[model samples]
Target chain A: MTKVKDIGEQGLLERLQRFCPPDVIGDDAAVLVTDPEQSLVVTTDMLVDGVHFSNATTSPEDAGWRAAAANLSDLAAMGATPLGITVALGLPGDLSVNWVESLYQGMTECLQQYHTPIVGGDVVRSPITSLSITAFGQVHPNRIIRRGAAQVGDAIVVTGVHGASHAGLKLLLDPQIGKHLTTTEQAALIKAHQRPQPRLDVLPHLWKILDNSKFKIQNSKLRINNSPSPQSPVPSPQSLTPVAGMDSSDGLADAVLQICRASGVGAVLESSQIPLPTAFDHWLTSEQALNYALYGGEDFELVLCLPPEAAKTLVQQLGQDAAIIGSITSDTKVLLHHQNQKIPDQVLNLSQGFQHFSP
Target chain B: MTKVKDIGEQGLLERLQRFCPPDVIGDDAAVLVTDPEQSLVVTTDMLVDGVHFSNATTSPEDAGWRAAAANLSDLAAMGATPLGITVALGLPGDLSVNWVESLYQGMTECLQQYHTPIVGGDVVRSPITSLSITAFGQVHPNRIIRRGAAQVGDAIVVTGVHGASHAGLKLLLDPQIGKHLTTTEQAALIKAHQRPQPRLDVLPHLWKILDNSKFKIQNSKLRINNSPSPQSPVPSPQSLTPVAGMDSSDGLADAVLQICRASGVGAVLESSQIPLPTAFDHWLTSEQALNYALYGGEDFELVLCLPPEAAKTLVQQLGQDAAIIGSITSDTKVLLHHQNQKIPDQVLNLSQGFQHFSP
Candidate 1:
């Protein structure tokens, strides 16, 4: 019997190359060779066997989609349009062909939605399953929105309500909590946890809003063009400036702290101003909601700071869905204001953010 | 202990999102934003612990460089200019940091040669070390080549001599052979096995030759008009016309058969004409050299077929470095003509290819 180690590294690579199609088989990465006018965008994420998922619960399909989506979210974060992806899968000998096919199906679904294809990959047998996906996208070089560009005095806003994914996870993991929820409620929460959507819809609108900020003095010309009549007037675009922003992958508190760290500023959040789902109140106390919103991770929502005038205009433009839950402050510390009192200084320092190296 | 399974698929992904810098974190894969006009090429290879390298004999640095080189060779085979890479490493907790850093250092050196940066990657603990690399390259779309395009009656040419790497491996694994060679000879053989170069220098010349082929007729007219004498001739560009081609990863015989199958044709190689390295002769018998050339894998040289007229021009242009080892034939079966006799059919039919699924 030949073991993988017996064949050696160069030998194993030689064997894997036999399976690749001659076209797109060799190159740094498989080249799409698409049009050159659009710039390329790239992202990567890794999954460990015991750390990322369990073979007992996660179907290969969900694992595959989640692996791809983890990287896709980065593209969405940059406001880059999706292109294609390459996957590197490590599997134990016990892995079945059926498992790989199902995983591919899940990945196919995500790729179809983004109009990207699986260009190439490497598959090798391992003692455990560790899947890593690297995705690429296209965007105009000038349109890339980085995390460091946020400004001070921008209205701090979040795209959606936080705590649903984390709450759903708690319910799924603990059967006791599952017993309290109806089947419909349980399914909704699980779906949110399993297949969260990247906020692709808001990208174009966000880009347009940012582009409008480039020309402040020419506001009258823009207003006149937008107005139906020459005499009619519209609000100035400068009043709606978006300053500093980031997507909340960590808890809201942690994400806000990161944004402040990047912008060299601080923030204060009003406890009453934070939004919560209707069912959240039924499951948790107000304190729990605050805790979940502040420290429970995986919200996948954008937290942004914009000018007060821009806040009003943005609200008018984006409607009531976007929430203004906090304000940037000069105090140089992220503070939670509750019931007309400042929380204890020690309470604000809780370290709940995810750490990759933590055992 | 927080097990990955307890977290579920979505929970694990959310956890991953927390650590990834939101700026370049997700999409179907990571989108490496680069200029659009630049050609994009991709290659991927996987190395499993025990199969590719053992902790006892193979150093981490060699393992890493070999892993990167395997993919880089595919890019070289495509004549694409190397650019960047993403790595996915699966490690055991017991593995030392010193080992991993050495691996990174080796990979960094190889990447630096091509000016390709390590754009992103995922690192996770596994039961064994499994490394996967996907590299990217840039080339003009017109210059990019594919393995399926080899034509019938094309001259089969190969870059450099084959079997040195395999000979080196034989010497390293067998101490008996090591004792037969002097210290200098052993070192040379070991070096060949450890560091295989991807021929990047020939890429530009190959591209130039391919470019000239496209407009030969139009260029002839322009040449006539510009010439001092009407009879002055415009030198014909060398041919890189591979109707069907592939790297000799699975031994020359298997790769040649692949080209034959892809082109729906066959091939004939003269046994006496096949180039064998001096070291190959020292370690292997004449019969063994034939066997290794037919079945011994890890010889990254390419096997290409070009039209007879083009072959003459290519041979002249490529000079002695590139050898015309064989030719595409009309027959359905790959044949070897030795002297006047065909030898026994069993010798040519010997299966000499690497199979990943072989138990």
Candidate 2:
């Protein structure tokens, strides 16, 4: 009798994927082809009381915002525009009504930012608080991004700096860590951990850059291939190659590895090119900062794979907001590039990300 | 300073409804008009350990079946056929892998019966296990049923006998409850509770009956009133009066009250006409059976409202599967009728259904 701990979260997910339908569990969000022209993308994430957040550290409002952002970030990763969401909450009986209301306020405020509404929900009593949010979005079927679509020679791009959230989490959990920082710096780091903004605003730029040339070709091909069957016009992976994408909720390294594994390719991450927030300079060593930048989770930033030209265009257009930190490889190993080293870089550290079941 | 226990589940939902968008939280499922021809109905239900189910009373397989059935029942209430569902799970690490696999097997089996697939999911670690399922379904926009559409003079109808599931739960929790019943009778009742079926098969008959008369008028009106705007063709409540509906997960009496409140109408339940399974005869009195029939939650049956003619047609088509339990009234009160020597019925007992936060 194997316990869930023995197999861990990844093993459990693999078990589910084997049991589920082929197209169901592999993507950032499940794509349901609603029509020939459009597809519906749906994703769900569950946050537990002790596992994801604690009352001592996260305010009810912040918890609500973070939960909403997590789901919204998934939609963004799939290149889908917001529609609405359903929230199912399990709360303790002793929780104050004010706390619940404040939580709603946070969720609503975050959702409103992206023009998404809370469409439906169920509330039940439990010993510990937990929130499960399911977000729905719509995208042109040809334009939907996937984790398995990273082509060889594609540039690996990431949005925003990392590690601030993890640092903030550390600071919140340990007051001694805050002693070295100024009050303003401490407040900024704490805020980063408390309120993560889903990179929904960057989606339009991503689509505009990737969808322009490839999408027009796919559109013409679709028109030529249109048949009586509704799903016949849906472009296949070979017909329209999308940028591999997912949000960095489970740490940057894990996000990249997931894409590589899904796409059956390798990656070369330039250690010097990876973005670390300036806040890390206040106290952390260069190596410590790099480690946090690579493996610290809950960034809520976009990780994208695109052709070099498209990546260049994205970086040129977005300027400081985006970075091309690596490139896809034919080899089936994720490696890192040392700035002054020759030929090869060591295989990237396997000790990465926060696994839910890891001791 | 108010606690969730003070307000209870209903009160918390009311609070959510007040804060959510007008069209968001009012129905068994929120209907999103995707195209002029179709609407997408989405509903979510969360089941928690100790609160909704216990390992002592329920197998993981049964828990999965119950959770899936609960969401499927919501889709049925809205006259929507399921498309797919996303399950977000929170499990404790010490749980056996077999238990988790069995849970998925039960969910998949139940979903497969209705051709609904598991499309997406997320799993996380938690102190207490919980399952949150969000179900997606589709229906013809004009034909979609609503909770707030019961008109005065409409007949109140119910599907299948009630109280069996609640009795089954009692038997599972307390072995003494089975003392008077034969083995077959006990098994039947226990099965009823563990594996309640969603009334999806009866939906076609319902649509065939109700849509034949009212739908034609509404469809013709829609064509004549079709405007350049896409949403303009969506029929208003005045244009198409659908049969008010919901599942009996929260007890028959509570279901009746919800519809009555939503539709701004009163109801008269004929006490003698309410259906109860024959298993009740083995151990329970007539009064006890009636209480269980009216107030026993988790039946997963349908409570419907229709014009007397339509109701008659439905009963004629469904036979024993459905029964005319009562009628809608203009007065704003829900009452129970006595079969003999009664000009007026008494107000229904307010003590009904399972309230999640109540002591």
Candidate 3:
């Protein structure tokens, strides 16, 4: 009598974890220690035609790019450099060959950008178009980041702005909303929803910081490239090891909740400090923008927990590229606070994200 | 203006090969040489509802087993020892959780039997059920088998009987035809269709022969278990290497044609020498049975081309488990002949092999 809808996606995942080996199901990617120094990270994601995208909104090329990006983001979460990927496509007979070619073009372009190739694939017949992509990568056994490693008192940091993708999706579904904004603003939001960039670019900087002396850091600005130049003279800080890390593909709140639950810690997110898009004030109320930042999904940004000094140093190094959103706490429940006033968590409905099985 | 149906699956594959890098798309699995001695073999297969298996005919568990077996067979073809597999499932919201649990049970059983565990996966909502499984394995660089290595004068050998799975599928789709069969016969045919075993068991024996001295042998009987015991006195012959090898999932004729095309050689199949299931003659005519053996697909047996002496040795070692049904030729076309007469190649329609897009 228990249907998939009754338990939801999380429930299904928990069931699968119980059914499979303990080490197999918990991480963003399964880490198989292949050698003394290197471990294999493998992850698979399935994208259904109706569930993941629609023909009305997503072109074949964009769909292909989105699918590849999603899997690559998982590898980024594990701090793994991709080896390659295998794409298995189930296409309907009525689909045009040109569409398929365009799809391959999109997928190949995205993969090539990340220095990964499409190493193998299978194309089969189906009633609807679907794609299943499995990406494999290599990471040093000692350097692999895990979601369950966050420590109490660790400062929370996030790369890039949140909720733009969600806002972009809203604009795409309702063109009338775009009438209120300039074409450039509309286009930026739409691009965010259609093409998410995996945070692979930030890994090298993070590893450098992790390898050096511990340092304190804090957030100030927003923009990855706008950060202080590498040549800029900055004070050396002590080496800092990241307590935990993951990609924020789900809404920011969901990402925080997952890290907290996995690490057996709680968090207090400073609402005023959370990053929002530059265009948010152009057309939307501050409260609406805040809601989008908190609950909007598919940001594809990196979320990390580090010591206070490390956070400060990272903020200084990355400049506006990274922000200090919150801090980990020993308390069992996640909290949200705006400046000096504590916000009632129930009113925010922070638990709501882009759940697949929810009505 | 062309649709996928117009080009068909093979045409689509050829197009993909042209689009992808030369080294990435041509093998049973993509063989990535990671180290001097070891190579990684990765393959992916996607199965869709109705197209692959209908809910009316296939239980959820059997569907799971079939999907796993299909991917594992690809690994076996490459002579690789599986490391693990990742499965991505797209299920409808109305599907029962118990159905998914049963599906996992089936996949687990098949994977465990081959010593490969399920490592990671993603499940999402879809209008129809679909499964994509990616299996990765490791093989010795020097020992890997390829489809493009057949040589003239090599003997063509096949493992087990062919067409049983196709016949099984036929029976499952049309129960009226199976009514003439006994209860045991019905069950046997149904089992063949539902659970085709990957030929991983034969890999070690083939490797042993490939590793050892070359020996001449011939097939006289029909059962793998009926072969002479290892303790029996058998003369050792000179060493021989396998020229080419692959699994016969796409029917024996297609397998032969593919090897010939890849290896740039011709072949002559001995019609009378081909292996058929014991139950074939009981109800079906000679021509119908032969048709099933030649063009009916999903056999999941091994088709190998080896030198005469090596083939003889393998036949002796494998006994009734293998059959020598053909030989490699300098001629450019694959032909079928009976005892003395060359059967007109056109009459047999050798090109037809369970094509997906065909009307």
The lDDT leader among the candidates is 2
The residue-by-residue lDDT of candidate 3 on A1-359, one tens digit each, is 99998998778978977656676558788977676656788999998887888888888888888888888999988989988899888988899999988888888878888888888898999888888999998887656777876777888999889889998999888989879788888898899888888888777877777666433232211111122224322212221234478888877787788788887788988877888888887777766777788778898888888777777776777776589998988876777776844434432234543231111
lDDT of 3 by residue, B1-359 (tens): 99999998778877876556566457789877666556778999998888887788888888888888888998988888898999898888898999988888888878889878888999898888888999998887656677876778889989778888988888888889987788888888788888988988878887777665423122211111232224322212221234478888888887888888887789998877888877887888766877888888888888988777777777777776588998999887887776754444432234554232111
For A37-141, candidate 2 gives per-residue lDDT tens digits of 678889999999888878889998999999899899999989898888999999898989899899999898899988888889999998998999999988887
Which residue runs does candidate 2 get wrong by more than 4 Å?
A175-186, A214-241, A340-344, A352-359, B175-180, B214-241, B281-283, B341-344, B349-359
- Give residue A9's error in model 1 in angstroms: 25
Give per-residue CA lDDT, model 2, range B198-226, as digits (tens).
99987999878866756445434433532
lDDT by residue (tens digit), candidate 1, B1-359: 45444544334445434323342222112222244334466666667888777765567777777776667777776666776677767666666555666787777776667766665555565677877777777654334444544555667877656666677677767758667566777777666566766656556655455456543443333233222213212223222223335567656777677677755677787766677666665666677776666676667666666555545565567665567877877776787767544454322443433231111
Query: Which of the predicted structures, 1 or 2, would earn the higher lDDT when compared with the native?
Result: 2
Which stretch of 10 consecutive residues in model 3 chain A shows the poorest summed lDDT? Answer: A219-228
Candidate 3 runs further than 4 Å off: A178-182, A213-243, A340-359, B176-182, B213-243, B340-359
**Better by TM-score, candidate 2 or 1:** 2
* Residue A208 Cα positional deviation in candidate 2, in Å, after optimal superposition: 1.9
Tens digit of per-residue lDDT, candidate 1, span A285-346? 67777777777766666676656665555555665456788787766787766654454422
- What C-alpha lDDT, on a 0 to 100 scale, does residue B181 get in candidate 3? 83
lDDT of 2 at A344: 54
